[model samples]
Target: MTRPRYGDLYFGLSDSRNEANQDRDSFLQTYVDLNGSTKRVVRGDKFLVLGPKGTGKSALAWYLQFAEPEGAHLALVRDASSLPLAEVPRLQTGQEPGPERTVVAWKFILLCNYLELLMRDQGCSINRNPEVVRVARLLRDFGFMGDASGRALLKFSTTTVTIPVPKLGTIYKRESSSALNIFNLIPYLEMWVAEAESAVRHILLIDGLDSIFLNDAKYDESLSSLVQAAYTLNQKLMENRATGSVVLLLRNDIFSRIALSLPDSQKMRDDLALELDWRVLSGKAGVGAPLMRLVNTKAGRALGVDNFEVLKYFPDSIEVGSRELGVRKIPTFQYLLNMTRHTPRDMLRLFEEIRRVEASGIFEESGDRLRQEVIHEGVLQYSTKYFVGAISNEFAGYAGGPERAAAALTALKAINKQSFDGDEFRESLASVASGIEVDHRDLLRLLFYAGAIGNSIGGYREKSYMQFYHRRDESEIYLQGNFMLHNALIHAWGLRRTLGNEPESQTGAIPLIDRGAARPRRRRRKWEERKK
Candidate 1:
């Protein structure tokens, strides 16, 4: 068996939807089912998938919508970014802008989508049912043949319609003077759904909510309402014995804000949410880990090999050293994984950089595997570009957010240390604090939430640990504890070791001490004590 050239290898697109769109076959084939997420979605056990950006939330959604073995399921993806969400709250029946009215609006839109699906899939059968036919005609008259805009759907809501109930021999009419609206159509839509005989289960996937995120009350209310509407609509489907469900893909931070405004947030999280956290365990960062397995699967498919070992295409170990622990060799996979925030997109970006480096031929390679220098260069490039860009994009929705984030990063870089106590961090940002709208503490929290920095919990004696916001969405950032910049951003920011003053190398190559070797050294006993 011959090995494939590095130039010929494919690491998949960083965007999940792009990969699905451009390479449908490969995308479906290489999708890693971490924690049986696809299965859970198929079973309607989970409807909400929450995670920080690049944690594969969208990947899981696209997989559910397009992966083969559809067996008894018809999945459709509706990207929320394409929908006019801002116009949704305006369509509220009441004068106030709140989630209640928006929830009703979302229900109407979702119901229209379901009706369109039924018309497309179970058209002949649904036409036989008077209620389903009436509902379909109502939606069709409003220009909802699928892919209708929010404004279009709003038109459907406000338009008065009279439907003749053939079975009851009476006309169900809405007076031109009355306030009858979309909410009134909900019961009829639910009736149609309950009565229609569709053999396959309908799964509606709502993704790309992050694309249209804005830091405002209305945006928050609209998003929160969408979640509530999905939950309520799904419950109605289940209660009415309709084999259908609605799944929402949301970023953890956005979901956190929505959760705060929601009264039953905990209950919804417990019953409806499936967090796509792929943080690998200390002992399990090897071949079997989800991130590594995903890479292996994609590499295998790209190379036309079955059961490809990731280490086969990369070095076994990389040299790492620190003052706390002498020079030691750590697994290359672990080293690479540490450079990421435990997300598949991070790994994919890293590999994509490696491929680019390989194609450039700037580093000498043995033609069998990626050289340590190549991987280091790839990490540097990925950190400086993709990682930092991702962090900037995370906070871009807020006012002065991008500038403030850049200023905060500059302050961190000026501090020139990997880890710092709260005061040092606060002091470092003081010079740039004037331009930033948020207080120093709020800025710290923003950095924490973006996965740029994390609290350093525990002490050396207890095996010091780092807790990132992405890993613990429910946990708060306590400024009382020490904080460490994420490894992925260390190179980009040119941070130094916590104990030393030396700046990080230009390639961002800091010798990280192996976690196992970072234990507190035991002091040698005195001679007298030994004699005793």
Candidate 2:
């Protein structure tokens, strides 16, 4: 929030112009349609944004509204139930306050957008349609003629038209007094269409609604909203292919629950539902294209000596072979510190506190990169809480916990020893390392993915490994990947070799963690008691 130095790094404050640009990008050019490699992506009726919190589902929706990719500006509903079935507006409900209101709000968007556009330049002007005139006559016969006089089907002034209504089909209205009032949805939409020939497409995006507060009965309100909206859009819009879209963005956890609750979740699959798999961005494995875009955007302003010589997001790598392997593709300003994050959100959260601390005047001068205490803190924060998320939740059936996790990291380097072949070291680790047991698999895989360890003649070498960023002046240690990759597991490995030889030496082989400025061995009893 510290203004990001007012350079290219800034995503820009939300204003009218910025909002317009963002909407354009979201609808027309932001995401690449990757179906051409062989076949096309199957377009579906809905788009479910399934990802963890902070993975940017809501941000994407905001971007969609800003882009207005389809032309008409977006409208959001705050709540579905609150929608009176007559009023219409695009819905964009957020998590705070009331999320359910979002669906209810958007249920009325189509009518609102159409009516708004009609009254834009003139008081009221519209194309003539026989169907609309017929429905208008029917409504007039029933004394339902809204506060307007149109020669059958005439241009209604925007100011004169007191409300937003879509020029769709004949509107069927049922007041709360009727038992079938809920079923009046079809008639209400049709009646509006009867007033005009212009087809106003409304893209309703519903967000919020998670299990954080709702009771079990209402926990998957987002899902229920999605189902209902999908049905409504298809039925009212005649399953039209060119217009109307409803995007429901929710967490993968909620979707999973709904899937189990439903008789068949697969039956509802659609193109609009999206999943944000942040794990894929780890290193260069995922987000390769988007990463390039981010880097280009950053490198432009960061290295501002010559703005005209604008370089590609990546430097012309005619020098460093593409397969040489590196992480310049990461976008976070603190990316150099994370050394392990895989998603856009991970990098952001990993350095949020550090960014706050730095901007607070703790670090203002430049050229302190090597000795910056923030680097040390960033390393600790990235690996400690996020990297683990509790070893059990992270590793599932594999061996977890910091200690065993460290050992598994070491084993991965052993498995990929370049002195031999990758296959040889992997087989060796698979056969001998007990810490490489089941649950530990993903941890090791992740380390390899992060490029923390490399197979080489001298075992595994940790090139960028930092030994507490607080000691920036010290030369970094580079050695066998297993020993250098995960310190605790390396110590465990060393102790394993000495176990049959000398008991005292084995005790010395185990490394100690630095509690503060001092490194001390962990007491097994103390740790176990803490766990209990």
Global lDDT scores for all candidate models = 0.69, 0.35
Residue-wise C-alpha lDDT for candidate 1, range 199-222, written one tens digit per residue: 677677888786654568768888
* Candidate 2 residue lDDT tens string, 1-532: 2222311332222122343355543223322222121011112244455655444555555554544434443434222322222122112222222434434433433333333333332222232544344433543442223322122112221112222222443332324331221123434543443333334344444554421322234435544544545445544543444334455556565565566544445555443345564433223332343433333333334334213111222122212113544322322321332332223434444343334344445545323232244443434554554444422232222224445545554454455322223344456556656544553334434343233332221111322112221111111222333322322222222322211221111112111111110221134335546768
Q: What is the number of backbone collisions in each predicted candidate, taken in the order shown?
A: 0, 66
Which run of 10 residues does model 2 get worst, by summed lDDT?
A: 511-520
Cα-based lDDT at residue 213, candidate 2: 25
- Candidate 2 at residue 96, lDDT? 24
* Model 1 ranges off by over 4 Å: 68-72, 83-87, 94-99, 122-124, 129-148, 152-179, 212-217, 252-257, 260-264, 280-285, 320-328, 421-436, 459-464, 500-532
